[model samples]
Target: MSNDAPVSTTHAPQAGTHEVILEMRGITKEFPGVKALSDVDMTVRRGEIHAICGENGAGKSTLMKVLSGVHPTGSYSGEILWNGESAHFSTIRDSEHAGIVIIHQELALIPEMSIAENIFLGNEQTHRGAIDWVLTQRKAAELLERVGLSEDPMTKVKDIGVGKQQLVEIAKALSKDVKLLILDEPTAALNESDSQHLLQIMDGLRRRGVTCIMISHKLNEIEQISDAITIIRDGRSIETLRVREDGVDENRIIRGMVGRDLESRFPDHTPEIGEVFFEVRNWRVQHPVRADRLVVKNSSFFVRRGEIVGFAGLMGAGRTELMRSIFGRSYGNVLGGQIIKDGKELHLKHVRDAIDAGLAYVTEDRKSLGLNLLDDIKRTTVSAKLSRITDGLVVNEAEEFRYAEMYRKDLRTKTPTVEEGVAKLSGGNQQKVVLAKWLFTEPDLLILDEPTRGIDVGAKFEIYGIIQRLASQGKGVIVVSSELPELLGLSDRIYTIFEGTITGCLDKDEADQESLMRLMTNTTTRPETPAAS
Candidate 1:
């Protein structure tokens, strides 16, 4: 699609028709050295999907934590009124006692537990203090049905895909007799089809008189589903807009979020294309566990210096697997492949070898794979290339701090200090830190997987500029993204992947959402344009 895609004019149904069921007055939450939320006021109707929109580190999640009692009553100075009565919750259980349940951005389910066990883990139905398996399974089955899930209750939580896992989370919430449900970035990790299904489930819950407060960076989804939107910016509530009454669109919500109209979602740039610096030929990788299965087929692609090459694919289309395998066989067993960099084939047997070969891969799952959350920013920034900060035996602390501080300022990472733990920063800042880690390696080729996955529009714009800046420095950047629009906006050339195979390639001028979708789905193939391989 073009940049001028029409804003959705559709409004939510029955907006502002119900009575106010939840309200917070002058909520102020503070940490050791930071005030997360200040005098934030919000109101939710008896049954409506309320959305919270803001840039990263704008206190949306912090506000939700206060409401759900994650911060507790005495910890934050706030008066919460539920159903016109003062409510002071001292713990998460206290909020749940009042039928308030929140599903965090990161799932809290146990991988080893069964779906039934995970659903009623802490709130199990018991008979004479003994665990009642029959009742648990039956109730879990019913809840699953309510959420349109057909999975068996006995199935392991890790066995299901992310979409189904999300449904299981909702089922778990339903088991609590929840009256008010909160979802933080619910669809951030889901594909389009699964995201739509989750939205439909939320709408169904609204009809069942369940109030929902959702914190999301996806303004388009917010525009489509929210009855009312509350835009939070810089630790304060900016404005509350009713979808029907105000006719709020993406741009309007964005303005409230960033305090200015975004004239362009992407920055304008003229390409300074150069010779091909990296090439992957006939790449094939076997599944890590399943030896008989091939995760990546005979995929072939190349990246040119000063050019941003985008890989577009659906979820489970092997995009991540391909990149990981190419980056020193990190994902699967590399059956056969040729990685040619600077016109010379290189053998990268390990991650260290990949780094030595002047290649860097920024993983999509930053929380798990890209970052060590326990470490501080200074440490994490140089962890990928400790040799740069180390003098044979010991790490030079001053050099580490200098590099961290430089990247922090250069990438515009929002943080009080480099000594702060990465877990304390927002998703955008953490991503910046991850980039800094890899950039410290001083790679000639950079592979970024879902670089802007859960970040806001403003942060995404900044990331795009950063990618372009890398390309401008004569580095070859390969971006693998689930977002088609992002590929169109940033990539000079885009390649489509399907079922572990490279389907086709298109230049910036030739690719659009529909065309790319067609190629991605393996429905059609474009002419294979030769790169510098």
Candidate 2:
């Protein structure tokens, strides 16, 4: 965006030139019961894109926190060298003052403020002790254009979607005159087009002499954009590989991160579909914002008892809307629909009704709608079915603790105790808590929306196993995932949706990535099966 190409920087010393902007030596950070980081060493070349790869809970974020002064200097034993000199930052403000900016996974934008105001929050343009609205709007507009966002600068932050908000965050960082930029899973919430756009923006920034340190689990994106890849595992630096070099493979990078060859990204499961257990007819849902527009058109599908049904679609393909509408009519306007459970029509007017009718929906966005962060594991596990612990009018503490403890062990949740706060747990563990909450309900049908998202491979396998076990226990399971491989591997039957319609349905023996992609992209039309004579 700055119209200046990045200056090529060398990693090691060559002749009389030394090429290093930032270097962290012997970094060690410890928590109460965990050694988050230990003897980690890393170096960043000026204007180079350096990628940090690791499994969840491998201390990648912890290392970045230390660099950004979130952990402070005295808490960690490390020497941060900037421009060939030792630097100690006491706070985030101190690091920012030194031309270092970090964009966290959870964006730090004020929802109530306009885009222009958010970009120039602490660093506003003032003229004669008064705010310069015209200058601020112009600068914000230029920054937005630079980042490939076409949204109005005066638009409220809450009105725009997550992807647009991400671009705004980057623009805000540019406003700070950042020299070293850190992005933590910036593309986690972006769709395909938006993700590609963000990656290109990062490339443009690199070309404009901006040094970047990206932490991401998206292996494909990491391999494509990174100049060098560093793998960390169990709080230790494994190895750093130059991706530009020959014979550097993704498998090798994954091995370095997880310490093993990932035999299969998705676990093996043979589904034995029985009689149809859940069915929907003439389902139509209106858009949440535009009541006149339909997000999910007249769609109908069914899942059998002991079957794993998969829904595959792109970002705006109406897969989530259909599920949410059926769950409780919780999402948008339901123009017309009838849900039949076990061959009987059931009322699903609200979340309570849906739950009572033997249905449960595990939301894709776990942070906001799924779990209660402020409550403990014991509380959240039983939150959905408080009646289980309620004796007459009051909840029995002993019964609640017993149920929570059972789930803690049964689900293999990684926590010190059941009383621990859900906020303190890892992403995978939090997902398990959400699963535990629904499993307590003992529903006949379980709808999992992106259940394994933002978690490690090991945790995904565990979730897959859970799904298979649920199907084996005669509970119908419906899984929605953007990852094609996951859908093909786990589902007994898959339904492809595009533009608010079910494009195709394939049995386990008939589905593959190519076929699914064809259906997803609307390239091939699905054949209709004749009704039973």
Query: Relative to the true structure, how large is the alpha-carbon lDDT of every model?
Result: 0.86, 0.82
lDDT of 1 by residue, 46-116 (tens): 88889999988899888888888888889988699999999988889999999999998767889889999
lDDT by residue for model 2 over 266-358, one digit each (tens)?
A: 666666767887899879998876777788887888888998989987666788889989988988889998898877898789999999888
What TM value does model 1 have? 0.92
Candidate 1 regions with alpha-carbon error over 4 angstroms: 1-16, 114-116, 124-168, 523-527
Candidate 1 Cα RMSD after full superposition onto the native fold (Å): 3.4
Q: What overall lDDT, based on C-alpha atoms, would model 1 receive against the true structure?
A: 0.86
